[model samples]
Target: MRIRFDNTWIADSEQAILLHEPGHYPVAYLPIEHVEEGVLLPTDRITTHRDLGATRWFTVAGPGRRGERAAWTHTDLPEHASVLAGHVAFAWRAMDGFYEEDERILGHAADNYHRVDIRSSSRHLVVRAAGTTIADTTSPVVLYESGFAPHWYVPRTDVDETALTATQTSTFCPCKGIAGYYSVAGIPDAAWFYRDAFPEAARIDDLVSFEPDKIDVFLDGKQLGVEPGQTVIAHGLDRGLQPDEIAHRDDSGLHNTEGQQ
Candidate 1:
């Protein structure tokens, strides 16, 4: 893993630890020794991590750019969290970019537990809105991702394109890339599609998925509905996310009942 800022490499480490706490996205913590010399300047700002204890902040400096309180480390870690004692974590939005090898990683640190599986299904899938059949297809792509409900994506050829009105709303998924929305029968953001997804999720590229709560979706003659508590609020650049950080973001889908740090 490597971090870049101000067109300079700030940190590069092959032994970085990924912390996956509840609610929040995975965060990468690298050894302080792997960070470039003089790039981290300690700051007086200090915060507390519920489990990790006292957290010290640092200003990340590179060339002519500086991110105030952009880096942090837990100074008084609990015994069980000792593995992160000598590690430092950078704020996702504060840096220019994070990379694995030559490819750039977006949204947040990739969660080892997170998985995206795409499968082609022959089951009949149908979508209706305002008493009109907007989409009907026998060949649909099923997208199963970690911690989310399965989304059925239909090819454009099977959809009634005229019934879809493009909307300005857009959301970004670290794994799937940017998702543009469409309104159906005057319903706002009732459908979404990924025109240019990340390489790993390319199978669903240019495919459309509808919101079950906003429209009537049926699969194999059975009405489809999202399970309770499965709906997620979209996270996008409007939330002050940087371009690189915009690639992946923490959505409200994950529950943070334990108040993890």
Candidate 2:
């Protein structure tokens, strides 16, 4: 389900309202400040759930105060008879446990995924290296899928390593929480993460290696190929499931169900 905040703490240049969730019913959770005065007609359906979940609904309208009737216009919430309003507080007084910091105010924790898509029609590169492919577009553009001098992630069994001269360089990603590096002879500038193996990126554990670059890239050729300046769609893989629940493979050879792979 989708949830949005009306009076977000974002900078003025940014939208004070944020659009969250694209699945299920979109729930609108506006900050108290975002609700215009007189428009909020509070409700009293306060009930506690066995799981400790609680919520309240409010009726909202506009023709607001002081010549301002559309305080919520900036947000995507539709104008209706009223709006829901209530603050949820949780206290796990069951066991000998209690949340002193009130994690409830943090709203629902979002399930984040690292999904990316690579595509380019200029040289049909994206389509060429669609299977078992990985590319990195960190800062300066480097094509890891292709055996280039700049050394990046390439298929473990694909790349021609005669040009590889492993260096001591390494880096990290806050998202996947993985770190590694690489280099080539006399070039001392190539880097590789893992080929079909990652202790951290179990989601993309099959990715051999990829070059991090400013612009996206694509690779094509031999065991390792080069199709620079292309985009690759990446995502996490799910764990165990029954045969009937298994996902189908796509033209890219990546198994995906719904919009996720």
lDDT scores of the candidates, listed in order: 0.81, 0.29
Give residue 12's error in model 2 in angstroms. 28
In order of listing, the candidates' clash counts read 1, 36
Which lDDT tens digits does candidate 2 get at residues 1-261? 111122111111111222233331112233554333554454554443222234333333423212111112121223331232222111111111111122111111222332322222222122112232223222222222222243333344444455455666544332233344445333334345533222334434323344333212354422344446443222111111121221232223122222321
Off by over 4 Å in 2: 1-153, 194-200, 203-218, 221-261
RMSD of each: 7.4, 17.8
Compared to the true structure, candidate 2 yields what TM-score? Answer: 0.26
Clashing pairs in 1: 107-248
Lowest summed lDDT window (length 10), candidate 2: 90-99
Please, what are the lDDT tens digits per residue for candidate 1 over residues 100-219? 876666667777888999999999999998789999999999999877889999999999999999998887787888899999989999999998777789999999999998999999
